[model samples]
Target: MRRKLTLKDIARELGVSISTVSKSLKNSEEIGRDTKEKVQAFAKLYNYKPNNIAVSLKNKHTKNIGVIIPDIVHYFFTTVFRGIEKYANSLGYNVIICVSDESFDKEVINTELLANGSIDGFIMALSGETQLKNDYRHLTEVTEQGIPLVLFDRVTDEIKCDKVLLNDTEIAFEAVSKMIKAGRKKIALLTTENFFNVSINRELGYRKALEEHGLAVNENLILRLPFNEQIDGIYPFVSNNEIDAVLAVNEIFAIHAMGILQSKGMKVPEDISFIGFTNGLLSKYASPPLTSVAQHGDRMGELAAKMLIERIEMNFVEGKEEDFRTEIIKGTLIERESTVN
Candidate 1:
């Protein structure tokens, strides 16, 4: 069986960049005539075919929008998708969703696949791998090509575009402050690595709360867990620390810690209270409902969709190209069984 040829393949075969191959094939004047002819000859000999979807999208308005997210399994992301779908549908735009599985390569491929004129604009959340690598060349390319883009939840400051975000730091500070006021002297923070902007903000808030309360910061109590590692991996950290309370950046961490604490003969809200970000199903359905900071995923999605559409419509204007806005959505702390209420 033979495999289909792609720009990447041609670029590799010719010792050129994917961008050069694409431009050469398009008969772009930016590419030298000799190089363009060479690329075309190679493509012709190999029976290379441009993506039909991309070809169709080049000259016509498909009224479709592309949405790229890290993963669909998370409750918060699912809720956000619902919001995007509802608002985009109401505006007579169809949505195409692509999951990157938190991979940098997958994220790049999804954007390249969808950006080929298939969708009018893009709304996305940065994948964990994208954040970790700090490589946003794919995103930068999309914006440079004059595509309307909107980032939500997990976003970067490098790209100038419409963004929807939760005031994670402020809300986290409030949540941690509440715990401190409830007599929790030693609070441990369970979070992902600082690669994630949300986690960094939440950790900063946690530190700020402790400092303002005159509590000593214990570096040993701060556990930076890998994103998707099992709950059992947290046992060592929990066992070694004499934490009076725990604050996790996400519901999964908080719930897992709670289970471990109970198994070790600790009572929820009695021996050690807990709080987490993202008021998702796990937080609500745990053995004892969790107190958490709700990020309002639905609202963020709605705003992201609205912002993208507005940019698409305003794209025709000349001077408006420089205009960009970052909208911060306020988070609310929901009191529940995990905390002293």
Candidate 2:
């Protein structure tokens, strides 16, 4: 069986730029007749069908950007959206948003819905189910047809596009190291499943901090939980593990763990210390307040919007392909009452 070809595949095989292939496929007069014939012939042989939505959106400047997020209620995602809206609106671009609800089908449907000439480009974070499935054909299709895309937070390497991200591993390392410095041992890590890129990086940082500090990484102390579900297993995990400090990948997990441990008669900062990622309201309002790693989601969103808009407004240089880039935002540790001073 022959694999379906994308514009990128056809361009690579024909030794031409993607722009040239795209124009050739459309039979634009700018491409030489011979080159056009060759590109079309190759595309025909491979049964390449251009995405109709992308074709309609091409060269039509809608001056609107589509933003898709995994969860609408998530503090980090909301902050990111605020930044994107502020920057994009300043530049005369309207922002349209859709929530994927962490479902792969919902994400794909949202992409399709937004791509139907409703917007000029897209800014998105991969949904948990999309990342778990590892299927990016929908995203690849949009890019293959000359649409600009910028991924933020939960991004993947499979898609070659502009991206904005936090330094998850480094920040997690800093958070764990701070706990160790405060004379805390038997540190436990609360994280999501390994499929999520950010979780995997955070776990790496957690392990690195422990190993570098002459402490062994204990698998039994690492608790894995579902990303978008009701909190469970926290009590049992806390009961089973003799941990002096805890580092959760997100604020919800950290706050929930703190509540459970406190109810079990463990005192915050005295009996146990806690740190989590995303310095959101929940962290700030928790009974003892929580120390957290601030991801700076607003700044990330602004950068992502800038990258996507720049790509959307860039003039095509005939036969040249644009180089994609990944921008990393540095995270800061917000010290609060949950940790020992």
Candidate 3:
């Protein structure tokens, strides 16, 4: 591994004071133009990246944001993360990423750990299991200690913080309405997460759409999907359910639902229609091309990061303000053969 470059190395090489090198690199106007130019030239030549931790300790700004995600392996979260990182870099900031893998304790611990003097703010997406308890006291504690936060994806309205969320229920309502208009009466909802606010909102939308069209909302048609689902049983579950249409809370779940429905001697469009969430890549090449709810994961992350940074910059330069805000993005429903009748 290459050794990390430091200020001392730059100072020794350039025969300048350590303060001169630091001020020039940090773009202090006090340094002479010719001297700043030379320092910058050397920095670029050596690919010297300054230590943000040390700078933050001295100047009270890390130029770094901490990101806490439930699962890094999830396509949606990763896509959002990419957007956050892209925008953060454009604004001259670095990212400190941590994964909690749906554990509440891990989420709390990561939040506390990253809220140290190392970062100016935090952008966090809560884990699935976090719905059971609202021990958001730790998050509040971070905010109280003066670290700005803007939440992403799995946000809660009760927390009194800024958030980024899909207009999930509206999209669900749209999907259900479209399927109904296409003449599919019995719509089944297949979801892996049954407890989160997103899932609950989706179900409410499904019911609202059905009610608007005078279609009966049968509880039996709605299956409570458990986390530990079996791969092979997917086929039998769809076959035995006898559902005419399916709406999924996630894209991967919807894609597999289509496969299972097709395997059990059931024909899509003619017999079943599907609409899933996230608009992931695999949904594009599914056998019949799955219809999906396109959650703009990247844009969501970027906006959340932008908001967090704005808050941090404001708080650091001026002072903390009470007028925090929220952002809710609309989800688009993309049509495909799987959901067409």
Candidate 4:
């Protein structure tokens, strides 16, 4: 292996002190422009990369924000990350992403890992286990230390901080209404998990819409798994039931429902028109294109990043730091063949 290059190497090459090389690389005003340019060129030629960790230590900024999620492989979360990465990069910042895989203990450890100046702020969605455990002392610890944070999607009301959320209840109502309009009468609600307030909000929307349409709300139709967990039993149960249509709380359950229904000799749209939320990539690529509630994931991410950055700047300035701010991003309906008339 080749020996790595360093600032000392640049200093040796430039016939100057390492301190001069340091100030020049940092673009400090004390260094003359000609000298600074010469040092920078040498450093670049030698492929000398400044240590971000050292830079962060000196400036008290990682220019890196922490993001915690249950799973990065999920289509919805991936889309959200795409949005976040784009915005974070455009603003000269990086993201320190961590996955807890729905483990409450893991989430706490990840949050604590970022607390020691490793991240300037945080933008995240709560892990499924974190919500179940309902332990938010870690979140509050970051906030109390004056670290900026913006919670999105799976945020809890217990934590008093800035948040960017979708109008889950309204969209849920619309999903149900769309199914009804498409001539599907029995719309079953399938959720992946149960502890999230957002999921509850979406379920409430389903009920509110069903009631508004003068349709009797059927308790038997709502199937919530323990811990809001997913199960293979749902496939056969859905096949045996007289379910005409389904309003999956999110895309994963919705796509899975379609497969289960088809396996039982049911044709989509002809047998049951469906509408899934999240407008995730899978929804568009499903055997039959899925009509969906396009949760502006990119918009959610941008909004969350903007909020956290603003809060960080605020805390760095004004010093008022008393009240927390709350905000919501609106979701849109994306019509597709899943509910074709």
- Using TM-score as the measure, which candidate wins? 4
Q: What is the C-alpha RMSD of each candidate to the true structure, in Å?
A: 11.9, 13.2, 2.9, 2.5
lDDT of each: 0.90, 0.91, 0.84, 0.83
Candidate number of the best lDDT: 2
Candidate rank order under lDDT = 2, 1, 3, 4
Worst 10 residues of 1 by lDDT: 52-61
Between 2 and 4, whose TM-score is larger?
A: 4
* Residue 207 in candidate 3, Cα distance off native in Å: 0.6
TM-scores of the models, in the order given: 0.82, 0.82, 0.88, 0.89
Candidate 1: residue 236 lDDT (0-100)? 92
- Checking candidate 1 for backbone clashes, the offending pairs are none
The digit string of per-residue lDDT tens for model 3 on 129-156 reads 6765756888889878878888877777
In the predicted model 2, the residue pairs found to clash are none
Per-candidate clashes come to 0, 0, 0, 2
> How many steric overlaps does candidate 4 have?
2
Candidate 4 residue lDDT tens string, 1-341: 96777778888888999999999998999999999999999888878888777778887777898998888988777877888888888899898999988888888899999888889998889988889889899999988888888888999988888888899999889878877876677888886556887879999999998899888888778877555355675776587668788887777778888887877788888888777888988889998988889888888888788878777767666567657777777888888887765
User: Which is superior by lDDT, 1 or 2?
Assistant: 2
Q: Candidate 3: lDDT over CA atoms?
A: 0.84
